[model samples]
Target: VLFPGVSIDECEAFTLAFRQLSLSGLADCQVVGVGAVRGEVVGIGGRRDVEQTFAETTRPDVVLVPGGIGVDRTAHDEALLSWLRHVEPSCQWMAASSTGTVVVAAAGLLADRPAATHWLAGAKLAEFGSAASPERIVEVGHVVTCHGRISAMDVALLMILRLTNRQIAEQVRIDLERAHEQAAVARPSWWKRAVALVRPAPRGPVRPRNEQLDTSDWVEMELTAEPSSTTPNGDF
Candidate 1:
């Protein structure tokens, strides 16, 4: 929910990526936020929707709690904690960014889960049995956490992965030019751009095979093909 000192950058990244669901092929997906009360303008200029109070908002399949200096106060808010516990059963996954982990951990959904939060609060999270990590993003089962606002973009992408498929997730990467971010991690053989199809992606629409094909195109294609007898050890 919107509150004083909410990480404006993180919220913006998350909200924008979520809204791209339609372009990513999840037209039905939704991403919205609420506040402790309706019509409240949070610190640094964030406003919750009209009449969108936490108590009035329906249970959500996914929840994202952002963090900032003010989140320190929320971490110890019993009333909010109680409300989160009350709605816990209905959540498909729960997430937090920056110091927001402190608040979400207070709700009891993070037991035995690995999580990450702003480096400044990394040690503080240890008290909650979260097995905190220094990584930018941590995921275990239905819980996701991001270290700080710097990782907000990656966090948003992870959220998309949870809500959709890899193809759609890859699309977001392309749109955001983040494919290199996952370069060190294992991915499908077909995922690397170096081996992408001869046809280009969205920036240049894929051309129809027959649009310029001539009878000799078949012979030209065969000339570029690897011989069927090519060996496993690079022998041709």
Candidate 2:
């Protein structure tokens, strides 16, 4: 479910990934939006109407909380935190993105656990008992947290892998990548040019060698390669 001031990109990443799975017959799942009330919740880029309120919704298999500027207010919301505390135990997974981790932490669900959050919010997260991790994604037991907005895609893909098989997850990844490429091609000329300017130049194809290296040659190459520097304490 989404909260007010949600990150549209993060919200869509989870929703769309699951929608794709259902559409492809890879899983039987439904995505629902729940709000404090039965109405619209304004998001960063857009607005979404929730079908159910906190009281109307049932327990879900997975729960996602996405971060945005609105989290500043939501983090302290006693009602929402109460609701989260109510639903957390029976959930198969509890995931949060960016500052959304703050909300989850505030709910008292992350005590003494390692979680990922926006780098800037690490100190704030620590106030709630979770050790903020530097990694892009951190999973502890059933809780998963991602470091930034874009990592929502990674979270979705990981969920797909968990809910289905690796093969199905791979297919979904390929489909998403292809769709992204198509969308890039459809962008306006100026936008495309701006992206092209920032994009790294494609590497040239490697040429195949006619001769194969023998075991002795491999050993010699490894021995001649520059030795890695070691620290004073003897750690590499």
Predicted structure with the largest TM-score when compared to the true one: 2
Candidate no. 1 TM-score? 0.66
Candidate 1 — which residues are off by over 4 angstroms? Answer: 23-25, 44-51, 176-236
Q: Report the C-alpha lDDT of model 1 over 61-116, residue by residue, as the tens digit.
A: 66777776765577777767876777667876667887888787867778867688
User: Alpha carbon lDDT of residue 119, candidate 2?
Assistant: 81
Question: For residue 117, what is the lDDT in candidate 2?
Answer: 88
Lowest summed lDDT window (length 10), candidate 1? 210-219
Clashes of each: 0, 0
lDDT of each: 0.62, 0.72
What tens digits encode model 2's per-residue C-alpha lDDT throughout 105-162?
9999998887888888888788888878878788888888987555666676666666
Candidate 2 local Cα displacement, residue 218, angstroms: 30
Can you give the TM-score per candidate against the true fold?
0.66, 0.75
Error of 2 at 186 (Å): 5.3
